[model samples]
Target: MNPFLPMTRQDMENRGWDELDFIFVSGDAYVDHPSFGPAIICRLLEKHGYKVGIIAQPDWRGEEDFRRLGRPRLAFLVSSGNMDSLLNKFTAAKKTRHEDAYSPGGKSGCRPERAVIVYTNKLREIWPGVPVIIGGIEASLRRFAHYDYWTNRVRRSVLMDSQADLLVYGMGEKQILEIASDLHQGVAVENIQDVAGTCYRVPDFDYVYDYVKLPDFETVAVDKKAFADAFADIYLEQDAIRGKKLVQRNGEACVVQNPPAMPLTEEEMDEIYDLPYQRTYHPMYEKAGGVPAIKEVKFSLVSQRGCFGGCNFCAIVSHQGRIIQRRSHASILREAKLLTELPDFKGYIHDVGGPTANFRRPSCDEQLQRGTCRGKECLSPTPCKNIVADHSDYLSLLRELRKLPKVKKVFIRSGIRFDYLMLVKDSFLEELCKYHISGQLKIAPEHISDRVTRLMGKSNKEVYRKFVQRFKAMNERLGKKQYLVPYFMSSHPGARLEDAIELAEFIRDLGYRPEQVQDFIPTPGTLSTAMYYSGIHPLTGEAVYTAKNPQEKRMQRALMQYWIPGNRPLVREALRLAHRTDLIGFDKKCLVHPEKTAGQEKNKPRKRR
Candidate 1:
């Protein structure tokens, strides 16, 4: 149940309900990714026969309204994102503040205020006896002290501040369902310790069976100072098999290094997508609506899961595992056909892609046979532990999607790994340029400097440029207007002012201007954040370059956007402050005299006839 939904708890009580079963809340817009977070838990509980509801974009006020819905014996689950927010402070569970009441489709560019943090604590204040579960991207990723990208160091764990009964990590569908099944049958939620991926506080410490363990989350009250101190040295290990200290209590913690939650098996994904949105298997989405009208819409679909492109700043591979799982071509076509029959089917399929869009099977099938991979984090220096990097089947799937008569156009909107795409055959590239040209293709080259790019585990920026050139040339020779749109990041650890300047110079040379610059937000459990916090490479555990604030990051970002003639003075000033004016323009000669640059000219340089 989305927590933001209006409630009529008293009406439900009058309808003869002794006690409510379960409730769910999320910060996500709640678009229904059924397999993730509350969506999964709700579906599983329904199968086991329990009344449930979700609250999306929750409102913390009117605590009485929530209690009036059912008796004291109830269970609640809360989530903020696809991953955990960086607010794990164990001794103190609830943040003593509330966020402004900005609804969904609102609140775009702003840091959450102290008020937003206190909004969730209202549940505990109102109904002290009910069981509350907080899991999801924000909770899971920040289950322990982790590097805070914005502030650039390990911060407190989230479990302490939110004070939920349980904080689950990984895919919690199965875990949460079993916990609820036992609870509805009258088992006390506190006694449910066998549940995997669950974090809670206990009365005393015990020897951890494996890497780490946690006390019941409820037992821990808010201790902001202790929580902050605990994470003072916390950071991520990019090459970690279990993802660095899977559990932490004060200074003590466990390292159950794991990757992305299990990906959808090809068969399972196929079955999910084929569900003619018109007639879903269960009443979950398709309640008896106004009519059996032709509800046809072209939907973008995920073709594979997990990524092995060990980019230090990312956590996708950590959460989803490096191995890619692909849905079958036939399965995709089946869904495409269903879309065509829809009343609104516009004969255009948005796209069929996932993580990298091109990678098909898990990276390494051979490694899978050898049992679990030792190299868990996909963002690593070594070749992916799962070596089965095959994309042919995926290419085939795209060809078939193009053939569907009802499908007028297919845009590869989900991102593509240009390096991997470059590996694709020339004919495939030509066809891709010819058929799949929805004007532009999106890719993440990250940065241009080789050292910085290598640190992020991304391909050389040169490769991306070449890829763009190939794409442009292929389309142009065919008289088609196609373009390459690359995504780049600034101020990743190891990216110093020199590197930023080089990237800016490269972009200037390419004659291609970026529409948007991605300012990195260090999510709770990412290696990049870890590297940023400790100034250490996550894999090698070696110290590396790092930046400490938004100002430094912003300057690096500005360098890319204002690389033309007019901003040379600004770049000079930034470089002087950065102590990186050893190169041209910043040399004493350029600094002493003001010379107008192409950036100042505005229009492209006039070609000297």
Candidate 2:
């Protein structure tokens, strides 16, 4: 049996010596993606002089792999998938096959929590006193509870149930280093409170600052549920969360819940970019007998970390930080050379960009680093709360990436912020059209309604229309066939029947039936989640619409994929349900059906307002 399978009594006896230095468990994902927990961590620890071995993709149903990797190690780190929605969407599908059913790995009923329960139990059985740590997008997003879309109610934090000695949230490079250092110095894992980014319970815990304190570990050991509940009920304390700190119950002794780690400094960020990344397949793909990702697809190198466009729906600002930090042209060229050397190298590079791709420098000159101009929001249709216009260095990198040998074509597959693109300096667009895009560009305009667009903080729908016109004129003048694959999001708060139908109508008029429409899923750690909770922007104090009904959400999602042929019945029923039966088949009479289009012309959603 594979070492990663179920553990048996023999498995326990087989676990070598019950002692080792570092045991790293990871969720399977592209190793090169910046957010990958295991890849970055394993490398970081090994850099600090630790013997690290990874057990990738351990089956919760089996314990053999767990047993093999088990040791009374310095520290044991656990990670679920890099994404939380990938896990939640997987679980949500089992309950509602009516909405698009998707799970993290696409297994029928495998949920994220089950991965936790199994791993925690196995770790306890094999190495009783050894510390077990949980990190990754799964741990970070649910660190606190804001809302539960599938159940339509607020729930407690995930920390209450995951059952790990500690939960490390966010990019954990520095924190994990501190953890390993503490363990090697002969400190008990429970004494790991000083390390930033770790959440644990200690006896008689109280921060020197004297705020809410953790329970004495005896209390937690005696009544785990009570301690878990204590951390979950903090409505007021969580609202003031800054970069990473432990949270404890109101008044408990001995228990210490270390907070998460703070953001990295410019110096640390620079160092991380210098880490060697050939950004390819798993080392054992040949013996493993599976197609590692590095085989068929090769993602081109681009920006390192950060996105200034703070779209509440996105996690980029929260996780990677909003300050755009870019790698130099020479560094990018080095990686490009390495990519070209790969045996499976293709003539094409998938993309070379980042959040709003065009942003290269931090948004402000040093003087106003603390804040931005109040009127800055007036610049774009949605004026992303975090938009930074960084283009100089970005353009330079683009130029260098296109000049590589054996690299016939370089594509900008990264999402284009259409609103920002329209304002691109004419010189930049000239370059953009000449060397980068491969005829088709992918951009997200999100929605058509000005009301929903602003609320979602997406660019105004009109800017998209103007952008489309300009793009066509440019292509025509250049005698080229370049076009955009504009992305749209439906069912955001403030979006109702009108907004969706308008988008549908636009799709039909343009004779463009998109293969997919992204219905918003409120992942953990996003401003979007906050808006869903309070129906207002977390940064701006303004009212917003919150979509709560499952059936309505289904209709909105179905509308996006309505062009898929199999979705026609659902689309028809939904149109009639919304009292816009005229759109059932888009007949000429329905177009004139007074009650479907808009205005006082008698066309209105016949369903429910």
Candidate 3:
């Protein structure tokens, strides 16, 4: 068993190391698990015979924590953990979030806002000329100029703001190794700009070639049209096979991004997952009750990487790419067997999946050679004719896992593409109902309105309804009373009050009261975020109406949970505003009663006694 990476100088000495090759600074607590990006990168480096140390969630307010590990020999790798710092710290309403699952003790304020920029700035302050490389979800998604929801303005690429020597976007396994190799051979960070999946800034465009130049930061910052156009170009060119090198001028410097790193093969996937991960948070965190993030992934086996679901609101396409890269069934089973050997092993294996659990291979055969279609989605507005929907590999993997000894149940808790499932002509659903699901299967059918769903790049209401019917039929055949907990989003771009009301009526008809509702948050680097900011669809250039007002957003959210007594007022107001007062009445079909009717019931309540 391999010991955890050194976090202190004494650990370095214990390992008989005089100096380290790289020091990773992360916004999340050090979790030596594959689920955490920092851990995977650090461990991958260690596997390549390099000395790596971690400085997880250091105090940016003081210099002590930053100086603890001292300067590294090669570079300082930085990330804002698995999630964007702004999204992690705040809600859709821009309210401060009190709990951070990534931090120790589930406490907020462990990492500074815009953590990549902050941490990188601190590293520069302390280590002067040492190379600083930034990646992870925050830096990956913000590799190009993007709209900041909190600031309500277009900000330059994180590479420009953080001033990191290189920005490794997407999965960093491929990029990190190349960067490390070059740095080990004594290559200057500035000359390493040609590496794939990395972004570097140059003072001029002299050395840059064969790249698509995006709209200048100054223009995109002010002109919405330019912002939409630039985003459209950025979105379509994200594929690894056919993607183009991109460059955008940020004031005096031009940030040049190389083509994305190629997807890892099955053997590569196995090699990375097979690394000696402690599979939990570092022991130092035990005193703080352990990191809150590990509970979700400790037993979970990541069967695959990447998703082709292509939801507009998701950042997977931008970060993990659209192609699906999966581990071999043997690799996954090996991890499951290992899970069974753990001291805390319960009979249950929490989950066995990745971004989209059902996806085991590329969406189509052409994706490997030609890449995904530029502006067309595989399973969106409609499933493309060429789209290949297969679940045999995944189903077989699940069956093998179920047959394992000491394993009670294997659940597929990761988001499953119901639309894709509907396309498969197999017994996967039957098996899913019988062995995988635990009474309820959660699926994201963001909104019921086809008009709104179209903007969200999700399947229309008809497809979701058909899938629901099929799920019910399958469950009935199995004699199980399982339910589909359909997830709904409110106030997404192009959703008006009428759309929200339409969704509310659908919920009323289904007699489903959603315990939680997702209010659309316009985070950086999503197609929906671009639409939310530009009021125009980047792909089609269509006008989209987004609910930016707090009250309207509240009403939209309330409409989804109309059954709750506390939401009655907002639901009533939303109904009235949409000219949907017909839905507000003292009738069985009504979502809420009128104010006068409530008052009358209050006054006549004495009869109840």
lDDT of each: 0.57, 0.59, 0.92
Which RMSD does model 2 reach against the true structure?
A: 8.0
Let me know the TM-score candidate 1 reaches against the reference structure: 0.76
Q: Which of 1 and 3 is ahead in TM-score?
A: 3
Best TM-score goes to which candidate? 3
lDDT score at residue 423, model 1, on the 0-100 scale: 55
Q: How do all the candidates rank in terms of lDDT, highest first?
A: 3, 2, 1
Regions of candidate 3 where Cα sits further than 4 Å from its true position? 597-609
Kindly report which residue stretches of model 1 are placed more than 4 angstroms away from their true locations once superposed. Answer: 1-20, 29-41, 71-74, 82-120, 149-154, 204-207, 212-246, 251-264, 267-298, 328-331, 341-344, 371-386, 424-427, 549-551, 563-568, 575-609
How much does candidate 2 score in TM-score? 0.77
Which lDDT value does model 3 have at 216?
92
Kindly list the per-residue Cα lDDT of model 3 for residues 1-609, writing each as its tens digit. Answer: 239999998999898888999999999999999999999999999999999999999999989999998889999999999999999999998999999999889989999999999999998989999999999999999998999999999999999889899999998999999999999999999899778899999887887889898999999999999999999999999988999999999987999988889999999999999999999998988888999989999999999889889899999999999999999988888999999999999989989899999999998999999988999999988999998889988888999999999999999999999999999789999999999999999999989998999999899988888898899999999899999998899999999999998898898887788877999999998999999999999999999999999999999999999888888999988888888888888899999987666767777756555
Deviation in Å, model 3, residue 8 alpha carbon: 0.6
lDDT of 2 by residue, 1-609 (tens): 223211233333465434447776655532543324566677666556675666665666766777665573686777765555344444433343212122222333333343543566667777777788887776665554435555555544455555577767667788788878888898877667677555665443334454454333244334434333333332112311232244443233222334434445555654555564435434343354432333323556655556655465876654555545666666667767777887877777777776667766666663124432332332345554454454667677777777779888777767666676665554566567767777877778787777877766677767888988887777787788887787778777778866777777777676666765777776656666666655655445566676567777776766766666555666666677678876755474232222233465466548866
As a whole number from 0 to 100, the lDDT of residue 270 in candidate 2 is 48
